[model samples]
Target: MATLLHIDSSVFPGETSSSRSVTDAFRKAWGEQHPEGRVIYRDLAADPVPHITATAHLAGLAPASERTPEQSAALAARVELIEELEQADAVLIGAPMYNYSIPSTLKTWLDNVILAGRTSGETPSAQGTPVVVVASRGGSYAPGTPREGFEFVQNYLEAVLKGSLGLEPEFIVPELTMAPRVPAMSELVPLYHASRERAFVEAATKAKDLAERLAV
Candidate 1:
């Protein structure tokens, strides 16, 4: 059975996050398809990933084969992130856009997951992990939309997931411009619920396609 890791980084669980709704849909379908599969979940919004401190970076930068005790320990935590990834055949990441980019917590978790000589080496062929990134926003960012400037999150994530990590990370974005849902804060609750429903449907379809391809 395939191992699936569902990583969600959304600040709003009660109100419903666009990204969170999608990721959960993906996980549910994936589980149904692979009934015997092992699944693990990490909610960064609830228990955030640690920020990479300067000291941690200093330690992490040391040669993997020559890490000192402290360096080894620091890098060890990062290794756990990668091991979880490596052991899994598929990964599902859900993150809401923050200031037109991925949340800092998600970014921090990625810093730990995409390590050298594991997710990728100095060489490109060595990198073959596949990732699925689901993003949500309060606005639209379709190719020709006026809010296309908000695409920085998708662009940055694709670059880092593929370029830095040397892996292919497919992006599934469901944009729900708030205008339709709410005229003002008073309508936000209703809009939030509507967005979640839409997000779940879209994500279920996208996830099935991705899971089938990856599982094969």
Candidate 2:
């Protein structure tokens, strides 16, 4: 059976969070296809990982046997985080845009797992793993949109997951998430629903495809 590492960084837990909802759909479809598969879930909003501190930085630089107690603990956590990714056949991330970027919690998780020799060495690879990102944005940031240049979530994640970690990824983005909730965006409600529907379809399709491709 394959193992999927599912990470959700949405502060909103359920249907309110578009990214979370889309990832749930993906997992639902993936689960149907791989009933015996294992899912390693990490809900960053409920149990947030710590950001890299000076001690943790030193731990990564120091030799394993020569590390201080705090450094050792910090390094051990990093090791566990990296191992989770290393063992996974595929990875799924729910990253909702916050202030035109990914949440701080997601950033913290990235900081924890991005080790020098492990995730980003000269021969770096997320063990040749594949990742699916359900990225939800509150407003439109497409090619001709006024906020196009300000969009950073998908671009930054692609850089880190592909460029830094050497992992292949497919993204499903649902834009204008807040249109239905904001009175000013009333006219965008149709677009919002359409984007959301498309995201779910893409998520399910990609999840099943990745699951089959990565199955052991």
Task: Provide the TM-score for each candidate, comma-separated.
Answer: 0.83, 0.97
lDDT (CA) for every model shown?
A: 0.74, 0.89
Clashes of each: 0, 0
Model 1 per-residue lDDT tens digits across residues 1-216: 778878988788833566776787788888778888888788988998788765567666677677677777777777777778777677788867888888888899987776555565686432666677888877667688788875888888888877887767877776663545565644455655566676677667766776687767
Query: Which residue pairs of candidate 1 clash?
Result: none
Please tell me which predicted candidate would have the highest TM-score against the true structure: 2
TM-score between model 1 and native:
0.83
| Candidate 2 TM-score to native | 0.97
Cα lDDT, model 1, residue 25: 74
Candidate 2, 2-80: lDDT as tens digits: 8899999999979888988999999999999889999999999999988889998789889878999999998888888
Among the numbered candidates, top lDDT falls to: 2
Give me the runs in candidate 2 sitting further than 4 Å from their true place.
Answer: none
